[model samples]
Target: MNKAFKYSYVSDFLNLPEPYSEGELQKGLLRQMKDFILELGGDFLFIDQE
Candidate 1:
């Protein structure tokens, strides 16, 4: 996790606000599903979210 995130992360494109909760982050990502998927590249896929 440390190697992947490198102690920080970015999602300015998603327009998510700062000091957000886990639920808020998840919802914000889901709201921009297409953009997130594209950002993930062609290797990953969005099958389903629970």
Candidate 2:
């Protein structure tokens, strides 16, 4: 059997909602995602837009 563990900070971050319009939220998410990829050594690639 496998046990699950959770981080409170990650939970809190995940629970946050986008504080903007749909398009704005999408833009923000995309920007953050790109930053995340780059921060993780720039080896990630986004293959889809939806």
Candidate 3:
């Protein structure tokens, strides 16, 4: 895909309705977790503390 396509895709995705609460927001983030990390150029990683 090209720059324009990527930009448009993100723009469209961002047009979705906003979340209502902390739980809802967290759920939304979890849903886009992978795509979010990819967009950040691998500078982000989720570490599980056990």
Which candidate has the top score in lDDT? 1
Q: Write the per-residue lDDT of candidate 3 for residues 1-50, one digit (tens) a residue.
A: 67767755232343346535656555556657756766887678755321
For all predictions, the C-alpha RMSD in Å is 5.8, 6.3, 9.1
Candidate 3 lDDT for residue 18: 51
Q: Which ten residues in a row have the lowest lDDT in candidate 3?
A: 7-16
For model 1, the superposed segments whose C-alpha errors exceed 4 Å read: 1-5, 34-49
Candidate 3 root-mean-square deviation in Å: 9.1
- Backbone clashes in candidate 1 total 0
Better of 1 and 2 by lDDT: 1
- Residue 20 of model 2 has an lDDT of 45
List ranges where model 2 is wrong by over 4 Å. 1-19, 46-50
The window of 10 residues in a row where model 2 has the poorest summed lDDT is 7-16
lDDT of 3: 0.55
State in Å the error of residue 16, model 2. Answer: 12
List, residue by residue over 1-50, the lDDT tens digit for candidate 2: 33454432232333336454667656666766776776787577765556
**Residue 29, candidate 1: alpha-carbon lDDT:** 78
Residue pairs in candidate 1 whose N, alpha carbon or C atoms collide under 3 angstroms = none
Sort by TM-score, top down from the best: 1, 2, 3
lDDT of each: 0.77, 0.57, 0.55
